[model samples]
Target: MKHYPVGVFCDFDGTISKSDLIASIAYEFAGQAGRDLVRRIQRRELSVREGVEAIFRAIPSARLPEITSYTEQLTVVREGFDQLVSGCIQRGWLFAVVSGGLDIFVHPVVQAYRSEIEVFCNHLDASGEYLSIEWDVTCDDLCDGGCGLCKPTVLRRFKPDNDVQVVIGDGVTDLKAAKEADYVFARDSLLRVCREQGIACTPFESLAEVIPTLEQEVSL
Candidate 1:
């Protein structure tokens, strides 16, 4: 085993949480319209930002509080999240939660680890008739647009020269980030996409599985 600095970029929606938060919110509040939009996103017919915006737009701005409350109730942090964070800290590895989800929901769920890890995500505005997304990050020249927070951009920004870049994700949004990483821990759709793309990666169902794989590689 060799020792080197490693940067871990993890997805939030389906990876850290037990389920996809945005999709859940959309289905619960936005109704059938939301389901259709989500399907379009899955099919790559619509950009992620477009699908998310369309879904939230269908829900009136007045329901923001209800949406937030619902999000909190629905959020269940996946097992081994804390351990993954701790492993990164102990080994002096850089760890970031790079989510395409909105801040309103992403914040509340990851509040416990706020001070420990860096988080990059989009913001939601409920000042108008419907919810609108505000982006702090956009796709770079290396990538085509669609990603709201742009995980690959964040991975490039945080991963230093000579350091190994590891990406962990479970959805379509994680695909681009996986391409940019030196190592990828993928599950579900992301795993399928990676295999299809012929990108070498480790398949994992839990963050716990990721920890030992990383530790073993870095000799930590």
Candidate 2:
């Protein structure tokens, strides 16, 4: 019997890392004006794609490396993250990082478990003076939200092989995906959305709270 065959999809920004790396880059390179746009995005006044595009457009391409490096230097993966990965591995779970942000920073922060996790995130085009976005096609099917790399689509790909669907996230990008999950581990913005939308989710601040649930729920 497959004691643990759950597939897990996690959000990268505030969920895994201590904070939003892209937002840090935005505040630094996009300036105060870009910060305003980010707020608008957070407030749901602007779409995530548009707001992210505008922020990157404001940043000079040359600063991409500096911004990524700075964000990586400060990024602290949540305590128990590696342990969570190990638990998943031992239990036969597939853990994936599905982020709306670019891959440049995602890889570095999760490098220790590089081979363990599958990453589904956007790519950057920094050839010009200003960085440009080349959104990833993580799923061929489009979500109603029109997220370039739809998180639900990523889960769908693994659903066939995996008997259970699990998602952990903390922000706007996670809202829709959470609804589709059989189990949701949420905090911050995602937790709020789950409550408001009537999606049942467990609120957790660290991976430690989540591991036992995974270990106990042998079948979904």
By TM-score, who's the top model here? 1
lDDT of 2 by residue, 12-128 (tens): 889888788778888877889888988988898887877888889988898877977787686888977887877777766788888997888787767777786688888889999
Report the lDDT tens digits of candidate 1 across residue range 44-158. 9998888888887788899999988888888888888888988887777777889998898788867887887788998889999888889868988888887867888887776
Which number leads on lDDT? Answer: 1
Clashes of 1: 0
In model 2, the Cα lDDT at residue 177 comes to 84
lDDT of each: 0.85, 0.81
Q: Model 2 reaches what TM-score against the true structure?
A: 0.91
lDDT of 2: 0.81
Q: Give the poorly placed runs of model 1, Cα more than 4 Å off.
A: 1-4, 218-220
